[model samples]
Target chain A: MNNDILATLSITDATRKLATKEISSLDLVRACRANIERRNATLNAYLEVFDDVEAQAIAADTRRAMGEKQKLLGIPLAVKDNILIEGRRASSASKILEDYIAPYDATAIKKLKDAGAVFLGRTNMDEFAMGGSTENSAYGPTKNPHDESRVPGGSSGGSAAALASGMALGALGSDTGGSVREPASFCGVVGLKPTYGAISRSGLMAMGSSLDQIGPLTRTVADAKLLFEAMRGQDPLDSTSLDPSFYKEGLQRKKIGVPRHLLARGVDADVLKLFEETLKRLQEKGYALVDIELPSAGLALAIYYILMPAEASTNLARFDGVRYGLSRRGESLFDDYACTRGEGFGPEVRRRIMLGTYVLSAGYYDAYYGKATQARRTLSRECAAALKEVDVIMTPTTPSPAFLIGEKSDPLSMYLTDIFTVTANLTGNPALAVPMGEVKRTKINLPASIQLTAAHGGEATLFSIGREIEAV
Target chain B: MYYDAMVSKEEVRALAQLARLRVSDSEIEGLQKDISNILEYVGQVGSIVPNKGETQVLRAQNVMREDILYGPATGLINKGKELLTAFPKREGDYAVVRKIIHKDE
Candidate 1:
């Protein structure tokens, strides 16, 4: 098979060919490897490509020969470094856990293994999944495949980059705030952040436990649905994991809500144009476009920054130089902890930790963390109320397309890129980022995306509408 | 739209110590600025009028499982050795730590 054709094949197409004996798992693996060899050096997508990929592919082929078949059987997929795969180094692209190996597979990985998916390798990410761009990775950033001068959009940037560049047919990413969808938009791939608890998060590194979800990034909406189906289920290990029937399907209204006030300012011109075009296209598809109000939506990002860092600081306290990960000794026990953590975490991680510490501290808790919690409740209420009237809420995934690698040097500026996508995470709603079209950059045409957020457990609606937009 | 939230160097140092992070003197000024800027940005959360007396209900429920030795019957518990191997300092099967209390105490 031609390498280009093999590399570009969707999981659905590849599986069809595999079932018909037109191609073997080895052919798919080799094609992905060829692309990795050609582009990974410059893209830096995979932190480490598994040395046993061919061996794994051979096992899948053997299983197929034995008359067993699965949807992802023998399919090549990229995994984010944050998801554990038992015995493999599952660093969240942080130096603290750089050499640490996972003791067990994340539930999602176990599911994929059961479905016979071939693991390519772990991809790069922002350290501790803390930043908007993969630039915070302890290893160098994963550059955009469309333009090496720009970033691939982050925490899951590497997973999206790998799929966009044909290094993998599908990939897994964790979304806390816009980690998965933002990168998917920047990379011009389909990224889905399942409704919270829709997928078990056991074995995935915890950033913001309440907000975190493991999702799929794929070339097509159907492929994304396939991966989501394989991974979504309640698990005993994760108390938060919801059963498939936890959320009843809602009545289809065929109405899309747009909070035009939110987009009135701060969005780039071309990006807004693309967003308007997508809304018009949806309107033409017989979906009623209505103006809705999410009055508290403006505060979602602020609430996220406060709540996420607070949760992150608490979760990261386990890394105290005693149990696991990097350790350094000092004069006293306190010094030991200080030295170890200071040397172990990167700048962004430390900043967030300190910010979290400050927010959750005695005098400031009610002012920052406490107030954020109340606002969060109000925001969730607002979203629930608006969602009652509309089947889905639409917005541009990011203010602009892929920005220059170091363009957002200031942390606040970078945080703004996630402005439109964080509300779904805050509300525990399913959100999908679909490529709307491309916007021209200086020398390249970078991808822009439209994000559709559905009511909780409304992933079916998202997938259906996302397919329509994809087709358009 | 400037906010009154400004983090001082002393506050940053205090937070660094509380968070178990060591910051060099050179990095303190930068941290002071960065933390102040971040706090200012996130402080907008405080602008929302607090809804008092209405108890907020969280979506999570307490989940309980039968307490028993649970693992794959395939000797997955032996992975404890791998966990033990990750300890920075180990004596036999125990992780070593600095002694906190002196005999005189």
Candidate 2:
């Protein structure tokens, strides 16, 4: 097969071929490598394409020859820089960990490895996964493959972009606050932020411990399901990891709840139009679209910003020029930490750390962090109630399509991109971003997406509905 | 728009210090503006109908397990040298660090 055909093949299609011996893992990896060579320089998607990928593919082929029948065998997938693969440089696009190598594989990566997946390489991300756009990557920004002048929608922008540009069949990205979904939306791919605890988080560099979920980014809902299945379930390393029985799966009502009140404004007109069209298509397919009111949905972004930073601040304390990562010596111990971190971390990370410190500090803890937690509980309750009535809650994954590379200079405006996606993170529900269609911007067609969020452990429902939208 | 609570330049420096990050004088002004704007926006959380002590529901749980050889994280158990290689300064088998103890000069 030509490299383009192999590189562009969905994980589902590629697996079928691999199973039949119609395609070798070596050819698949090389096809992906061919695309990476063609476009990686322009897209800046992969920070490092693994040098041993050829050997990894050969090993998988040998395993297959020995009667191994793993579904993901020999499949090449792009991994976010934050998901640690042992012995590989797992920089979260931060300078501080420039030389740091993962001593252990992240549970998700381990599961993928066991399934016989190939690691294409680590893709770029915002430093510490702090920003909505990959522009904040200490190394540099990952440009959208659709429009090079635009962003791929961040934190996981590189992973999304890599897959979108055919560098890999699928990719892994961690979503703290819409990092995975928003980029998936922008890059015209399917992104799933599985229910919190559905997948183990061990060895994945911590961001917001409560919100971070390592999820799959793929071209099709089935492809996403394929990858999510291999990596999901309990691991002793991540106490938060769930047993399959944690949340009882409910019957699908063939209903979707749309919080239209919150979407009255902020969402771009074109994007909203496409969203309604998708709803109409689903309705024509015998699905009910109910207008649900989630009052707290309006505050989801505000709550996410406060709580995520608070959790992040505490989570990041491990990087104080100590046991691992970059270290700097100073006249005193304190100076050593201050200098090391100040030089190592990028601006967005510093901003979040400071924000977290301020919220968790003695004086403001109750007013900011404490209040955000209360609001979070309320939001979670609201989502649970809504999901009980409907199979999934729907919204535009992002307020608009991918914006120009330097468009959202103001931090607040840049944050608005995640407005529709953060609710799931806050509520611990699974959300999927599926490309609805494209909207024209600046005379070019840019991808727009629809977000469908299901109740905790309702990923199966999400996959079904996501497939519906993909059909639409 | 009014910011009920604002982070001044001095407070930005203090927060940076508390976070153990050294920010240049130039970064303080930007941090002050950006943080103040964010705090003001996120402060809207205060308007949420209080969940009446329900905030504790989100409080973290102790995830520690008995010290034993088990689980995937055990992959880190014997790779002491690889972990040490990431340390910026190390002496043979130990990570070097600055001493805090002082004697009367």
DockQ of each: 0.58, 0.63
TM-score of chain B of 2: 0.79
Give per-residue CA lDDT, model 2, range B7-52, as digits (tens). Answer: 7788988888899999999878888899988888888887877656
Evaluate model 2 with DockQ and give the value.
0.63
- Model 1, C-alpha of A453: deviation from truth (Å): 0.5
Candidate 1 regions with alpha-carbon error over 4 angstroms: B1-3, B51-53, B56-59, B71-76
lDDT tens digits, residue span A139-251, model 1: 99999999999999988999999999999999999999999999999999999999999999888899999999999999999999999999999887888888898765643
What residue runs in model 2 are displaced by over 4 Å at the alpha carbon? A247-251, B1-3, B52-67, B71-73
Taking all chains together, the TM-score of candidate 1 against the true structure is 0.97
Give the TM-score of each candidate.
Answer: 0.97, 0.97
Model 2 quality (TM-score):
0.97
Instruction: Tell me how candidate 1 scores on lDDT.
Output: 0.91
Alpha-carbon shift of residue B72 in model 2 (angstroms): 6.3
| Least well predicted 10-residue stretch by lDDT in candidate 1 chain B | B50-59
Candidate 2, A61-107: lDDT as tens digits: 99999999987999999999998899899989999998888988888
Clashing pairs in 2: none
